[model samples]
Target chain A: MLSIRNLKVTVAGKQVLNGLNLDVKAGEVHAIMGPNGSGKSTLAQVLAGRDGYEVTAGTVTYQDRDLLALAPEERAREGVFLAFQYPVEIPGVNNVYLLKAGLNAIRKHRGEAEVDAFEFLTLVREKMQLMQMNESFLNRAVNEGFSGGEKKRNEILQMAILEPTLALLDETDSGLDIDALRVVSNGVNSLRRADRAIVMVTHYQRLLDYIQPDHVHVLTGGRIVMSGDKSLALELEKRGYDWVKEDSAAA
Target chain B: MSLSAINQPAAALDHYRALFASRNVPDDALGKLRRASLERFLAGGFPTQRDEAWKYTSLRRVESRRFAPADAMPIGADESQWIADAGHRLVLVNGRYMPTLSTPAPQPPGVTILTLAQWASHSPTQVADFLARHDHAAPHATPPTANGAFEHLNGAFSDDGVVIDIAPNVQFEQPIYLVHQWCMPASARSAGSHMANPRIIVRAGAHSECSIITHWVGDETAESLTNAWLTFDLGVGARVSHLNLQEEPSRSFHIETTRLQLATNAHFGKHDFALGSALGRSGTLVTLGGPGANVSLNGLFAPTGTQHLDTYVHIDHAAAHTTSQQDFRGIAAGRGRGIFNGKVVVQPGAQKIDARQSNRNLLLSNTAEIDSRPELEIYAHDVKCSHGATTGQLDPVSLFYLRSRGLGESEARALLIRAFAQSMLSTVQVGAVREWLEARVQRRFDLSAGEHS
Candidate 1:
């Protein structure tokens, strides 16, 4: 469902993603495990079409569309969702309003009828149950003054409501407590379907325990060095990246 | 300053020389009050930049031009079209009350709406004490009043301003729109620039509620200057919402002073939106006189093409536990320049005072200029006060973000500008007024796609 070939991204002339390649089929969950500064975040950013990152060379194909040509918001409307590591607090913009706007933009792009407020509220409430978010969350400004756990939960809530074909979770577990991680991973697990894919970016093997992935890719120096089942995440956690680096060099 | 040739010579300099000799001022107590105000105006002439409060907006503009204290010529033409948008309006022509054009409303039993000329002509019972209290001359005001040309201008022409008194427990649901449309026909044009000093006094009694929208409108690029002053004395538990919309023509110049005094448990809301004048300068001095008094002042302005707009807001925390929150936002496009200087004075023993002030400005073009200063004068030991000022262009990321969401460039920019102003407009407690304000703000920003939005 997703193919990123030889992708390289640079920020301020410093190469962040170096010849990164990954593929995920529908119904498959791919976990990209890497240490800090190993380019895990950059891959998500480049795929999500965020600004400030220069795509030195890359070709990203999502369902046969040239993903790199789309704007960040266009990419979003085309079923690409990036769960930000730290969501920007848009003051005076209500969360429900942001959600409604995001949803309607995607729907309009797909030739779907725009949901009215009353209907959208009902649909949003149903998704709210999946992430255990309070209905009151809709009233507050978008992530303004929200706690870390609440922010992560809000991200999961968005993923559930958006139901993106290709969702990228960038360090969504970094700030969550163990309990929040379980709830969020459970939400992701329930979202797994035959036609949807998720690329989970994490620094710890802990999140994979909750939402076990069919593929685990070891990322080091901006490239995927090793690929395996969910056991790869555990192995890297036990042995660390030095062994992965050595293994790649030997190969 | 260019002092005009006094037609009446030494006699004109004699305080009431212009009013008495020309017979422009009618009605007794109002006339007396106007004469007394001139005496006070003479005591304080034209303030200069040497004074701390007038530091940013130098009186150089007025000091450079010779101005004459105006003599009212009975304007033969009626200007009912100027108040076309207002629901209930009282027309004050040349500072003289024209009851003929005023819309009748039930006035409070003891409250009055008398022209200063009428007050002087009739010698009303409480008019003397009431008029004397709001004497624009502050004993300790910087540069005093004598050196302030605009104050002196208003003082000298004070014979025609209006006085409104609100009786206890009276509430006027609809906002009274006072349209001060001053015009001297093209035939009356003179060589030296002179001014019409228009004044409005609003006194709200205890538990009374009132709203006044004093709109200053003028000719299409008229060659005149207006030095207007307004003073509001709010009694205990009274609530007064005052909005001064300065929408004068680009050819006109305006210098205005608005003062407010809050009594115990009273609340005051004042908004000043400046969208006019070649060189416009407005100042407000608010005194939080009693405990639990709440005051909020918000101002917005956008100037373009050689226009200079200056605003000075001063809040005095005189009594303990008083509160005030002031925020002013401005956008300057083209060669327009804007200046905002706000200071919150927390006097000693004014403990538990909560004051917040912030002024943010947006410069849309390279030639546009904005100078903002938010000063916090804290003499009180126990108080929470904050002052912040920021000037910058729009955020490129946010701009791009909105554009990517299908907004055309102009629509996207307008949306962001509207959002920047929404926070201020949302604070309007009156529904109809808020709607009007929102529309006016959109117009001020020139958000072209307002209807579609």
Candidate 2:
């Protein structure tokens, strides 16, 4: 469902993602683990089409289409969702309002009818329940004054509503406590399907324990240094990234 | 600033003096008041940038025009659309009362709604008494008039407007809607610009409560000016809510001055919504006279094109335990310019006074401009007062977030701007008034195309 070849990205004249490569097929979950400054977040940002990241040389293909050429909003309409590491706090925009707009835009892009308020409300309420979000959360301004865990849960709620074909989760478990982490992982687990793909970028192996990944890749110096099964995350968790850094250096 | 050069508008001065002479005004106390006001206007011709109060706004556009007194033009049936939803309405055309267009409901026992001309001729003694009792020079706690030229101009050329009086302990269930329409015929525009000076006086007696919605409407193509003055006096323990809606066309100019005074334990709340007019200025002065008096002033102005809107507000916390709050918001798009200057004063010995003032502005375009100044003057030792002002564009992150969600760029902007302005519109406790304001806001923002989604 997604392919990237020699993804060389630079932000502010500094190479963030140098010659990084990744590939994922439908019905599979992939986890990219890296220490700080290993371009784990850069890869997610590049895939999501955020501005200010100059692609020195790369190609990202999604569903047989050139994803890098699309605008951020266009990518969103094409079923590409990015669960930000830090959800922005928008003071005046309502949470449910943004979700409805996102859903309707994707539906419209797919040549479907726009959902009416009543139908949209029902869909949102069910999704909110799946995320265990209170009804008042729908009326509150988007992420404004929300706790760290609450913000992470809202990102998951949006992902569930958008139902993107390719989802990029960037450190979704960073600020969550044990209880919130369980709830967020449950929301993400419910979104697993045979036709969808999720790529999670994280530092620790804690989230991998909940939403087990089919494949784990260790990134170092902006490149994928090692690729293995779920056991690789446990190995890295026990030994830390220094062993991987040494191995990459020796290679 | 040299005083002579600042006060030199001989042509405009001559025009107004000529109109005053033509009027058949009596030489009684009321007439002397008019003369005194005219002299004051002459002493301080038209406010210029040199004046601290009018620093950011220029009256050159108004001074350059040669405006004659507005005539009693005919009111078409279509013009009545402005007051169609009003249950008890008093309509004025070119500052003159239009009984035919008015739809005044049967009044309650102690409520009186009559035009200034009718009150002057029919009840001269009562008019004199009311004017004398609240004389400007009297030892009242209310602040003096703030807008010199406009207030004096309105008094000098004042033609006629509605006077609503509620007797003591009389609570009016229905609001009195005053619609002032200023429109010049196509031929009149050829002769010269037209101007109308309308004055309204409202008195809420002790323990009484009432509301009044004043609307200013004009022709979209007319090059006219409407100078309006309103004085609201709240008696002891009275409550009154005033909503002033200024919707003149872009080619028209509007100068409105409102003076509100509250007595012991009285409460006065005012909302000023201005969206139209090529050049508009709204000056409001609120005074909390007696202990426990409270005043709330909320204002919102959204101007596009080359429009210029200015708001000047001053609140006087004169009595102990009095409270006052002022919230003003402005959105300037295109080449529009918006100015807001709010001042709150806690007088000497006014202990326990609480005052708050804020002015928030949004600049939607590179060419748009906003100048906000919030001032606080506290003489009392035991008082709480705070003032602040902020001006900027929509948060870039917020805008991007909205766009990424599928709202068109314009739709996203409209939603955010509406939310910002809604902070003030929601303060309107009256449902009908709020609904009317919402429709007007939607129309102004060009959100009529299902942009609410």
Candidate 3:
């Protein structure tokens, strides 16, 4: 469903992603693990088409189409979603209003009818229940004065509402407590479908315990150096990322 | 002085003298007051950039124009822009009260509503006495150099306006809606341009409660100047809410000065919206004269195209245990320029005073500019005063976040712009006024964003 080959990227005149390659098929869950400054977040941001990042040389193909050529909104309309590590705090835009606008935009792009207000509220209430979010959150500004755990849950709630085909989670579990982690895991686990793909980037292996991944890849020096099954996350947690760097160097 | 500098003021003074002479009325008390005001305006020709209060705004464009007094010719004006279901309506066309267009519904007992012209014709001496008393009650809060040239001009030329007097202990249920509209005069094509000066004086007695909405509008084809003066005197425990909406034609110029006086336990709230006019300036001065007096000022100014909008606000805490708050927002697009200067003063004996001032601005284009200044003068040691100002463009991160949610670039920009303005729009308590303003503000930003992309 997604493919990246020798992705060379630079930010602010400095090369961040030297050479990276990754591929994921439909219905598969992949986890990318790396230490600090290992370019794990860069890959996710590059895939989501953020500005200020120059793709020096590489190709990214999504569903057999060049993803880099499309604008961020066009990519989003085509079922590409990125759960930001730090959700922006918009002071005046209500949370529900943004969700409705986004959902309608995607629906219009797909030649579908816009969601009615009543139906939209019903769907949102159901999703909020899954995320264990309070109803008062619907009326508040988007992430304005929200707690760390509440912001993460709001992001997951947005993900569930949008229902994207390709979901990229960047450090979604970094600041969540254990209970919030469980709720967020349940929300994500419920979204697992046969025709969808999920890619999670994390620095710890604790998240993999709740929502198990089908494949685990160790990213070091801006490239994936090791690929194994779910057991690889447990092994990497026990040992460290240095061994993977050494193994790739010897190879 | 230079050769033309001396001759310029002389020429301008003669022009006004001729205009005043043309009135040809009896030399009564009201006439004398008008002559005195005209003399004051002539003494201070027009404020220059040297004046601290007029530092960022220039009156050269207005000074160079020759605008005769607008004739009292009643013509059919488009009423589609008027707020629907707004309380008892009082319409003024070209500064003259239009009795045919205004609502004739009788006001409740203890509420007296009349035109300035009516009052002046009936009791000229009483009207003169009231004006003198009002002038003395609310002194100029600006610097010495910042003379009241336009206000004095209004006093000299104002022929008709609204005068509302609410008796003590009265509670006005419905707001008093006043509309000051301008239309193309029959001879405007031949004549260069015209000017209108309207005065609104509202006096609320002790323990009275009321709301006032003043709207200014003009025809697209009319290129005129409107100088308006409004004053509100609140007795002890009186409460008043005033909303001023200025949306003149693009070719028009607008200048307004509002002075407010609050007595013991009186509360005053004002919302000023300056959205149109080629060159617009609004000055508001609020004085808390007695203990437990409070005032809140909220304003939003959006200047698009070549429009230049300026708002100046001054609040004085003259008594003990008084409080004040000022929040203003400015949105400037195209080559427009916006200016906001807010000053707060706490007198020596005004202990336990709490004052806060905040001004935030957004520039939609590189050429758009906004100047914000917050000034504080404190003579009391036991007062808490805070002020802050920030001017910036739309947050790139916030824009990207919206775009990533499937909103087009222009849509994302429009949404963020509305978000910036939503805080001020939400403060309008009247439902019809709030919705109308919300639509107008949104449509404005949407068009600007469309032009950009």
Candidate 4:
């Protein structure tokens, strides 16, 4: 369902992803584990078509189509979701109103009828409950004065509402409490399907305690240097990334 | 002084001197006021940039042109339906009243509206009080005394106006509408120059209520000048709302001065909307004489095709516990130039006084220009006051946001502009008046934004 060929990415004129290649079929959960300065977040942003990043030498294909040619919102409408590590705060823009706009934009591109306020509210409430988010979150301004945990939870709520086929969970577990992490993990786990794929990015193995991944990749200096089963996460947790760097260089 | 620095009719001042010289003032309180006011006005003539309160706005529009007092009053009752919602109408053509065209409300037991000519002919003392208490007292009250030539002219030409008084604890449902319809006498040899001196005074008693609407219209094709000084007073525990709509003929000039007094626990507000004119400027001062008083000054201006509109509103919290809030917005298109200067002053010991001032402008094209200055002068120790002014084109992000949602680009821009301006509409408590002003804003957006947005 997804393919990447020698993806060379640079952000702010700094190389983040250097010569990385990957492929994943539909029906699989891939966890990308890397220490600091890894290209994990850059991969998520590049996939979502953020404005700044430059794909110096890469070609990304998703569902057999060119994924790099769309705008950020357009990519979102095409079922590519990037759960931001830190969401933006848009003042005077109602949380529900913004979410509704985002949803309708995606829905319209998919050739679906627009939902009315009442219907959208009902759908939002159910999704919020599933993500264990507060009802007031939908009433306040988008991400304005939100707590760290609240921001993380809001990303999950959006993911649930948009229900993207390819979800790039970019550090979704960062800053979340044990309870919030479990809830987020559960929300992600429930979306696993034979026709959907998810690529989770994180720096710690603690998230794997709840949402186990079928495959694990270690990103060092923007390239996937090591690919293994879930045991690689456990090995990294025990031996640290210095051993991974040493081993990758030796290989 | 450079002729280019002046803004209005030169003969307007000359005609004003002639009008007052011709009127007979009885030897009473009103006579004393008339004499004292002329002296003070002569001492402090038309304001200039030297006055910090009017630092950004030039009174040249009032000083340069030559105008003659409408010469002979022209008829205005061709059709009374023009202002149907105008509950109680007071018609004055060229500063002179015609009772046949006026429809005053029942006195409500204690409220009265006496013209300057009538009040001057009778009780001079009652008229003196108004003139004596007219000057707004504050650090900026003197306003550098930068030689107010037109003020002296307005003082000298004050032939007829009105004195409105409301007794304590009285409330009226209908707003007093003062309609000034002017026309340059077709036979008059004024040719390139014509002028009209307009005067109006309003006083509200303690705990009393009063509202007034002033609308200015002239022959759409005539080119003339106008000088006016409208004074208002509010007693303690009283509230007053004043609305001024200046829609001048396509080719005319207007310069007006407004003096306002606010007593302890009194609230005074004025909303000024200047839409069309060859050249127009409104210089006003509102004072808070008593503690715990509030003043709200709201204004909007739209000028097209090289039209010049300038508005200066100043508020003084002379006593403790007084508050002032001001917001003015303007749109200049077709090479029009719009200027707004607003000032808020909080006196010493006026702790807990809250004051805010904001002025914004939207220049639709490169040729169109807008200048705004919002000033705050505070001597009080514990007051909350802030001021800001910004001028720019439309918000591209907001426009794109709306357009992406299926609204056309023009519709998107109009919606955002309307939302930007709706802040002024929220203050009008009268439903009909609020909707009336809103209609003009909507109409303006429809016509102007259609071509550009």
Worst 10 residues of 3 chain B by lDDT: B136-145
Over the stretch A22-65, how does candidate 1's per-residue lDDT look in tens digits? 98998899999988999998898788776789988979999999
Candidate 2: clashing pairs of residues = none
For candidate 2 chain B, which ten residues in a row score worst on lDDT? Answer: B444-453
The positional error of residue B15 in candidate 3, measured at the CA in angstroms, is 2.3
* Candidate 2 structure quality by residue, lDDT tens digits, B102-139: 87457889998888988888888888777656555456
lDDT of 1 by residue, B1-453 (tens): 234533322333453344434656644655566566566544444565677666666554555554554444445534632545554578865445667777775664655777765765676656666655655554633323322455555655654678777888998767777887656566556645656677788999999988888877766624667788888899999999988788776777788888788899999998888878888888888889999999989988778777889898888888999999988998887778899988788988899999998898887778888998888888979999888889998776665544333333565556567777777777766566567777776776664323222
**Of the candidates numbered 1 and 4, which has the greater lDDT value?**
1
What share of the reference contacts survives in each candidate? 0.08, 0.42, 0.64, 0.00
User: Residue A205 CA error for candidate 2 (Å)?
Assistant: 1.3
Give lDDT: candidate 1, residue A132.
Answer: 87
For candidate 1, give the lDDT of residue B209: 85
Report the Cα lDDT for residue B48, model 2.
79
lDDT tens string, model 3, B1-453?
Answer: 799866775676678778888988557888777777888788887888888888899887887777777774746877986888777889988888888888895789989889998888877777987888665324544332333888788878888898999999999988999999887656664577778999999999999999999999988877788999998999999999999999999989999988888999999999999998999999988889999999999999999999999999888888999999999999999999999999898888889999999999999988899999898999999999998999998898888888888889899999999999999999999998999999999999998876551
Model 4 C-alpha lDDT per residue in residues B1-453, reported as the tens digit of each score: 677335234354444456556666555665555555565554555566777655656656555654556656665443432356766788877667778878844666787878887876687665665565554322345342322455556655566787887888999668988877666466643455666777888878899998898888766646666777787778888998898888777777777777777888888888888885788888777778778888888888887777888887777778888888888889887778898877777777778888888888887768888888777788978988888888998766455433323334565556656656666766776676678777878787766776662
TM-score of 3: 0.97
Q: Higher DockQ: candidate 3 or 4? A: 3
What ranking emerges by DockQ with the best candidate at the front? 3, 2, 1, 4
What DockQ do the predictions score, one after another?
Answer: 0.16, 0.52, 0.81, 0.08
Task: lDDT winner between 3 and 4, please give it.
Answer: 3
Q: What is the DockQ of the complex in model 4? A: 0.08
Segments of candidate 2 deviating more than 4 angstroms? B1-8, B77-87, B132-145, B446-453
